[model samples]
Target chain A: MAGELALVADILSIISLIIGIFFLSLGMIGLLRLPDVYNRLHATTKVGTLGAFGVLLSIILQEGATPMGIKALTVALFILLTSPISGHMIARAAYRMGVKCCEGTCMDEYAGKRRK
Target chain B: MKRRLITYMALPVVWCLVSGYVTIGSLFLGLIFGMIVVEPFSKLYRLDEVVHPTGDWLAKIPKKIKYFYVLIKEIIKANIVVAKIVLSPTINIKPGIIAVPIRAKTNIGITGIANTITLTPGTLTVDISDDQSILYVHSIDATNPQGIRDSIRDDLEKYVLEAFE
Candidate 1:
């Protein structure tokens, strides 16, 4: 029974890691190909957190709720907590730095408030 | 009073997680340390008191769990959408910022909604007004900003209300 569980865990871990790496690779591609800092930030923040969560989840599944598994969960929690805040801060800073939104961008709500 | 004491319950729980120890000795030590640690900043945890409230916290626990379930679903959906866009042959994203007026009253609720919006794919919360009435959101595609606003109001803000309010 233990061996079977381990086999299931191994399979899950392998699949999760593959999918995680796949998402991370796309985030990297988005970083390179996106036209501006804001777009790249979107790609990296949203995609990267999920990718990291996937890897951490696989670790938890492999370890079966041990202390390390709990710790991994905590790390994942922190990732979710901090990633978006950091992304928001950077995006705000980019806008403050006068980073241009993409040419195709149709609106700017913060534009009027920029001068004041 | 009663609510603050209830808020104290989280301290040892966090201690157990961060210390990564479940033994009786560690738990006793964690209790001692948690008391010392949580005492100084009890006021900061006022948000917890407000969110948890005095009555029916145990019963309402399921709602918070449900919110997280929805959040995780949205997060995964977001990543899949972003992955598709990133891997597309030609990038055709039309990006812009739009103002979204929110109804979340508490600080925690507002922060929760903002973070949820920012974490979701294709949408990022760029700014909140001084009065905290509006969240300026940057979207990777803004052809229909009203749709984005409505989706956030319905999908994210309602859950935040469920969990925190």
Candidate 2:
């Protein structure tokens, strides 16, 4: 039974690793194919967070009772907290500099409301 | 008082577990050290209650799963397109920055939207408005900016609304 449990854990670890790889690759693709800066940011943020989660999950599975797993989780939590803030700051900077969207873009909610 | 005690106890326990040196004496020492360190800092920062309609934990799961699914599909599709572009030797990439109007009001909602954007790949969040109502992004490809905006508005903004708005 212990052997079976170990095998299950191994399988879970492998699965998580595969998922992480998939997310990383998808993030790369979004970097490549997305049509605009905002869209690309969207893709990266989602993939980066999920990719980190996948890696952390694999670590937890592989080192269930180890200090390494705890450290991995701590790293994941930090990523979760800071990544968004970084993204927001960057996006905010871009908007203030007057980046333009495509000509036919719909919904200009901020139109005529620029704080001069 | 409750939060302080919780923080004091939780920090040392977490430290001890993560450090992997499990001893009663060390645990006691760590607890004392944690109280010494954490107590003084706790007074410096005050915690504010930020209420959410969907709650924080549950809001992320479904949206994350959906994003994972969509991202995988997009990756496969993008890989083929990029392969073709690379093989063609024309280097037809058109990069540009675009400003997107944001609707989310709260700090959590706005941050969530921005992070969602950065996670995807080719785009980076460049800036947000002072009022937190606009997002600026830099994209490696800017052929269809509107489509990109709509997609974000549909996928991420909806989730942000559910999560924090």
Please tell me which predicted candidate would have the highest TM-score against the true structure.
Answer: 1
Report the error of model 1 at residue A62, Å.
Answer: 1.7
Q: Report the alpha-carbon TM-score of model 2 versus the true structure.
A: 0.58
TM-scores of the candidates are 0.89, 0.58
lDDT of each: 0.85, 0.65
| Model 2 CA lDDT for position A101 | 54
Clashes of 2: 35
User: Model 1: residues >4 Å from true position, as ranges?
Assistant: A114-116, B2-8, B35-54
Q: What is the lDDT of residue A17 in candidate 2?
A: 89
Residue A33, candidate 1: Cα error in Å is 1.3
Q: What CAPRI grade goes to candidate 1?
A: medium
DockQ of every model listed?
0.74, 0.24
Give per-residue lDDT, candidate 2, residue A86.
67
lDDT of 2 by residue, A1-116 (tens): 99999999999999998988877677677667655555455555656677777888899899986778877877776776686666566555555677665443443444445566
Native contacts conserved, per model: 0.78, 0.28
Ten-residue region with minimum lDDT total, candidate 2 chain A: A102-111
